[model samples]
Target chain A: MAGTDDRDVRLVAYADGELDEDAARAVEAELATSAEARRLLGIHRETASLLKAAFPESRYAGGSLPPAPAGRARPGPHLLARPWAGAVAASLLLGCIGYGAGSLWPAPIAAGPSRMLAEIAEYHALYSRETRHLVEADASEAEHIRAWLGPKVGRAIAIPDLSAAGLTFAGARLVALEGQPVAALMYTRPDGLPVAFCILSAPAAGRGMLQAEREGVGVASWGDGTHRYVVVGEAPPERLRHWVGLVQRQI
Target chain B: MADESFRQALTRLLPRLRRFGMTLTGSGTDADELVQTTCERVLGRAGQLRDDTRLDAWLYAVMRNLWTSELRRRRIRRHEGIEAAEAVAGEDGAARTEDRMTLAAVRRAMDSLPEEQRAVLMLVCVDGLSYRDVSAIMDIPIGTVMSRLSRARQDLHARLAGEADGKVTPLRPARRG
Candidate 1:
């Protein structure tokens, strides 16, 4: 067997049809005399042939073709049948709704943080109850929590002070939202009630303040220039709102 | 005048167009999307199709552009685990299971190559575009395309050969030539 070297690599390249006529011919001449070269060439050809044989047969499963901007319906059926058409349509529709609604909504100062709160509350509900795996890291390791989550989230996040709010900080945990890492701070009031504050880096393009009501949890979210925060709890809207305000001052 | 004619021609080529889109995208959903986007763009710029003879390449160029842009967008959004090709490869049933596996392996190997090499190999080997045509499509010098193709093929050969040893069963003596 010929030792695999730069020359053998080059021969492999030649077999791929990468070389020009002169280069290919030179390699071919070498192959004529070298059994190892011949073996290598055979392997290359067989691999290429196998790949070609595996190339999929194209089938146009028909449905609707895309419409022209002029709204002229093309000769085909409606584009809705095509899966990508639906995705593109959904994206366009969402973009339009977002654009239109964005104009109507006022840029509330508290809205971004409130939404983050809601996300935190939800995260709390899902994982806070777990005794063995309640959080990614325990609250005692506040420094490590910040270090681990800060760079991933692309923003500096300080866990908020909740002792004054009548809750002990149970520590912060890392979570994922829309592929971006988020920071969640869990706290338990004196009565054993758990509350959470979730913070995510604000999208670069910015987003309008979004308020959500899920189950019995009230979430208020607002974003500043650098970060978006959400506060979630079982407390009434006004109470959650107040805690968020305090958190805003501390963080 | 050309716009209407282009639309007419595209309607006829839709099936092959879809197939090419599927092959390139590796996902039926994304392939359909790429084809639709290509159609929309083609329809919008009907006047651009001055040469009817090169319509196939033109459509391919449009599809390729859209796929590249979509990939960039996904990368920027940090949206992971959204592989369109893997999704499509999983959809084919047991009848063509072996073929699908082979193609999937090839696709993985192709993806493992650098972007430049992958593009060159796809254009020349799969798309059956000539070296000259690939040069035109990629907007690179012919020599560059050749070099990339060589590098791509060498890498793919190594990967596929390695895969064959573990995955492929040896042919019986009677079948061996």
Candidate 2:
């Protein structure tokens, strides 16, 4: 029953205790005489109550809270709490101090194997559940996917065969890593969980196998000095390792 | 503030930060992530924040900025399926009790609001921030904050009332209450 008048805004402000005494008294005076104003004020209170109920902090009490980042304790620059962030910090520390002395540093400080593992896991978390946009190219286009992404990545980007590991090829997409092209092969288990094998051209430093798990996803990165691979999935460590092993042999 | 004192202050703000994140993301899981990211940003850029600045407003601004960038990234990643995912999150086992069902409906309607209105509404109604604080957090004028908050509450009231009436009218420029 309230009109689009200044009193409507004033009534809300007054109800929310947002007004000074003078304006609040003005609203209270209008409320005492105007039935429409009273009803509108009631609606404002009801709306605020509804909003509090809808997004109640008490509803979130049961959920666990992540630990305060160790950055608070560290003397240096504050760091993000994610597991991979620690890895990045370690890599940076080593880079500044000169690792391997005469030998070239064994990893790219910017996006090392651990960083790649973290990134792949995050990608799986975001896009693995998608149906329509699961991949840029479907499984039927395996040859075309290879043809499309292989040259761009400067390597033979083959979609791995994991049939023995209970995964069927879903599709592949050409993604970018550090301004270089990479290929991601998407697969789905019979139970509908997704797995991806990301292939990138890494420098001589980006070699060897590194395994890390984050946010319920198991990630493993390995490369033969020229080509690096990271496999990400929601499976247990053994299962993910088995699948990654199979894919590694195939690729 | 000293590093130890700043960290202690941030620790105390966690619950409010989580609540604000919940309002912005509309998903409990995403809210947790948003809170973590917000804390990380706050600590990482603690030097940038003035000691005299309002810490709560600064934190809310950081969370809002992060959510905006996250939306932009999601838009680039895909088009159709993101909404479906959000829908699934809203209805995920929280509707068993009737009260929870009503709350869920209210949440979905709030989720449908424009981000500006939702931000202001939550800051004022849920977090109980003053209009001046919300204006600072959202980088808008106090007049804009009031108008946005009034419009938000009006829209929410109509949407909830419409749900009870079984009409489910599409949200529009709400008429006078």
Which runs in model 1 stand beyond 4 Å of their true positions?
A: A1-28, A59-64, A71-251, B1-5, B11-31, B44-47, B50-53, B67-100, B167-177
Q: Which lDDT tens digits does candidate 1 get at residues A61-157?
A: 3344445667642333222332222232222110011111222122111111123233444565776566456567788898898888888767776
lDDT of every model, 2 decimals: 0.55, 0.62
- For model 2, the local distance difference test gives 0.62
Best by TM-score: 2
Q: List the residue pairs that clash in candidate 2.
A: A1-B177
lDDT of 1 by residue, B19-129 (tens): 555445433434444576567667857665665447777777767766666655553211111122343223356548777777666755654555456556655665566
> What DockQ do you compute for every candidate structure?
0.17, 0.25
CAPRI classification of candidate 2: acceptable
Chain A only: list TM-scores of all candidates.
0.49, 0.53
Clashes per candidate (backbone, < 3 Å): 23, 1
Over the stretch B57-125, how does candidate 2's per-residue lDDT look in tens digits?
Answer: 888987777776665544421111112223332333645678766776676577557657777888988
Per-model fnat list: 0.20, 0.25
Backbone clashes in candidate 2 total 1
